[model samples]
Target chain A: MDLNLTILGCHSATPRANAFPTSQYLEINNRHFLIDCGEGTQRQMRKYKIGFSKINHIFISHLHGDHFFGLIGLISTFGILNREKPLHIYGPKGIKEVTILQLKLSKSWTKYDIIFHELSSKESEVIFEDEKVTVKTIPLDHRVYTNGFLFTEKPKLKKLHIEKIKQYDEIEKCDYNNLKSGKDFKLSSGEIIPNNQLTLEPDTPKSFAFCSDTSYKPDIVPIIKDVDVLYHEATFLKDREDLCEKTKHSTAEQAASIADQANAGKLIIGHYSSRYKDIAEFKKEAETVFSNVELAEAGKRYSINSYPIEILN
Target chain B: MDLNLTILGCHSATPRANAFPTSQYLEINNRHFLIDCGEGTQRQMRKYKIGFSKINHIFISHLHGDHFFGLIGLISTFGILNREKPLHIYGPKGIKEVTILQLKLSKSWTKYDIIFHELSSKESEVIFEDEKVTVKTIPLDHRVYTNGFLFTEKPKLKKLHIEKIKQYDEIEKCDYNNLKSGKDFKLSSGEIIPNNQLTLEPDTPKSFAFCSDTSYKPDIVPIIKDVDVLYHEATFLKDREDLCEKTKHSTAEQAASIADQANAGKLIIGHYSSRYKDIAEFKKEAETVFSNVELAEAGKRYSINSYPIEILN
Candidate 1:
């Protein structure tokens, strides 16, 4: 299974000369999903060469302008492109009303169906699921209602041991399907062959958690514990801890602490404040607590199974 | 008095790799106004180095997504920037409802006052007027309720003839103000000097008319007759006249015809459809009917007082 995450934009409040607000693209198990579209998300997607038609599912964390202001523009573009596939949008309550009103006023209805899944649960719940992966919500503490998303791949089938299977003459080629499904094979001699002896254990499922625009709260650590990769918002530096608390945002040190508490395999920090000109400081501050820390830059692709890959500027 | 127009984005329907939707910045008598903010307008403004604080008023032609989808994002950015000056928005009815609802849902109210001047008139009416300029709406024919805007500069004060004024010692420095106001001066010998002899005539009040997303309607010619510059939408070519008629859009020939009938000093054509790759064809088609024709390219600036100046790419 391949799990790739691409950073679209990572600035905090507003888009500036070289910085944009929060938005990302996650491709897990060949499924494409867009996360948190900011003001110029469509243009950013174009810049990154992300196909518009591939993203059928969009997850919006909150109603903040920096998070979802580009949604209407993207939707309108989809309409103009004459997309026929149904688009599914998952967001908090009131998102439907806001989007519908704009469409109504513009009188630009899409030919494709737009399905809205309004989420208002305080507890974590599964929002999307398929045979290959599952997506769940992570309720967070914020000035307004907000929710994070966690994507986890399903368990893989057992790998067949070719040499061990060849040792048994009675084990026919047709029995390989049963062996891979973790079932014992019955030999022609009326003897049972254990499944473990014929197959090797499969690789562990990979999981990724995305938490943004949330205050530092330890309660979410358990929900995202032991994830392969965790992306958390670090909107401020340690010197502005007071400002962070008042704005319901987290500092780089706080984000690192959450990753440390969760015991994540790797940590990616983003949503940097526009005031901070040097983004390398965020990685430096996060590395104090989390050993594996990476700064999320636009157009960079990070893989959960492999190390990060930086695209040429 | 200087009247300058900058093209921020000039494509129609959708934004593409090298094309953007409709957006323009107009500066008249030192006052700046934004016309038809499409998606990515703010970024385009930044790319052209247009100051955000300089735009105190924004005009929306209609409720189409390509025209006003960027308004909400621009407004939210103003809030984040901590703008204190009041911002005024003028558009057709239902625009206020759409903008206010999104702001309410996000709970991101601007610190600055946002005064919405909702317009829903079938006849031409003055929507905005100050000492320097006046803006009026030109009713247009479109699929939806739409209106074009006409910006006209107020008559400027007469220029003082310093050499001629110095000839008469009786003309005190304080009395020069009255002479500039088009009032004649009387000497002590009962000799009266006419205002025209003492001062040259002021530059003719410059005007600019913006018409877009509408079919060819000659009714607006009288409203914008003899304007310094006229920007009309040329969404299709002559070959796609059927498509233009069905979509309520205009061809290059039709737009030029309107400019020729209105007797505009200069005609600028924009809003090219994405299908047309070579924009020079639009200028070619329009020039067949009107000689003074220019293509509206992004980042290009057109001065009403002088000929068009092409900025190097």
Candidate 2:
């Protein structure tokens, strides 16, 4: 299974000359999930060729425009393309009202049915679960009601051991089915062989956590502990910690401290404040505490397999 | 008064590589009126550097996604910027549903109130009338219940008689004022002066008609008669007349026929079908009947004050 994330946008509240606002495309087991659709996201997706048809489920982190402005346009595009499949949206409480009003004023009624799961509480809950993955909300502290997402991959079947091939040759025909079902193998001499003797257990499932546009809150460590890849908001540097506190945002150091406390495998930071011209300082500050720190760039994709998170093209 | 139009996007359905769905920016006096905001319109506006904040009212042609997808994102931007002024939107019946749903899901409620004027009937009534201009709906025939818009500038003041300035300074001032107000002037020596003798009549009000994504309907001749500028849909060439009929679209020849019947000053045809790579044929076919025909290109601005719609920088 290929699990990866593509960064569509990474700017904060104000869109800069070259930077875009918050948006990310997460692909896990052939399914695509959109996170935080800021303004102009559809164009960015088009430029990057992220097919809108592939994205059926969308999750918005908060009520900020920089986080979810592009959602309505994306949904409208689906309508124009005559999409018949139902689109599911998970976000804060008022998103449905805003989308309905715009559609009403424009005289556009969607051809497809839209299902919305509005978030009102500040507690962790299992929001979406399927055969491949399960997603849970991580409560966050911000100006508005916001929540992060934790994506955990489901464990797969174990692989057959090659060393025990000859011993089970007599019952190999039936052993193939029995081994896959975790059953014991019976030989022609009436000797029983354990399933563990012929097969090895599958590796542990990998996980990723996304904490978008939230202030520094250590309370989320329990929910995001030991994630393989953790994406956290580093809106400001330590030098601007006062501004971070005033605006209810997280500094680079604060984000790094959270990753360290959670003991996550790797940390990825984004959503820089517009005040900073260069974001090198953010990475430098984050790396001081967390050794495996990666800065997010637009159009970059990170794939998570059995190995470490590898940045793809 | 300055009257001009900027073609932001012009296509029929979903946005393609070179063909963007319907959207046009109209400028009269100093205010900007956005018409038909298709998906990715905000990106187009930003790329072309059209002053977005100048737009106070938006008029959607219909509820089709290609017509008004960009509105929600634009409104969210206004909220993010903390704009205090309210925005007025005029369109068909279903627009409010789309907007309200998005707002409800994102939880980013708008700080500014949005006024929606929904149209369900095909009446040719004045929708908006201000000091400088008046906007009216021109009922149209299409696959959906759609209506075109007519923007007409108020008649300009009479030109000052520069040559007769020094001869009668006392009577000239009053004569010019009376001429501007469409009245006859009297001399101080008890002599009556004819309105035409002192000054010429004011220029007629310049009018622009927007006929988008509709079939060739000659029923609107009276509503758009003698318009100074007419923007009509030319979705296909002459050979694809059958396709135009089936799709409820207009060919280049058909769009020009409407301009000919309306006695319009000029015809600007756009919304080219994606099949045709060379759009010069559209202009060539339109020019066969309408002498003053121009092809509407994206990012090109057409000024109405000038006789021919000059492309602005």
**Each candidate's TM vs. the true structure?**
0.96, 0.86
Q: Write the per-residue lDDT of candidate 1 for residues A1-313, one digit (tens) a residue.
A: 3788999999888776567789999989888999999988888898889999999999999999889988998999999889999999999898889888888888888899999999999999999999888999999888889999999988988999999999988888888889988999887788898999999998678888999989998899999999888999999999999988899999999999999999998888999988898999999999988898889898888866654433234
lDDT of 2 at A46: 80
lDDT, candidate 2, B136-236, per-residue tens: 99887777778899998876777656665455656645445667665666667877656555566666678889998789999999999999899999999
- By summed lDDT, which 10 consecutive residues of candidate 1 chain B come out lowest? B304-313
Per-residue accuracy of model 1 over B34-133 as CA lDDT, tens digit each: 9999987887888899999999999999999889888998999888888999999999899888888888888888889999999999999999999999
DockQ winner: 1
Model 1 misses residue A78 by how many Å? 1.7
Worst 10-residue lDDT window, candidate 2 chain B:
B165-174
Q: For residue A274, give model 2's deviation from the true position in Å.
A: 4.0
Compared to the true structure, candidate 1 yields what TM-score?
A: 0.96
All candidates: DockQ:
0.68, 0.33
lDDT of 1 at B30: 86
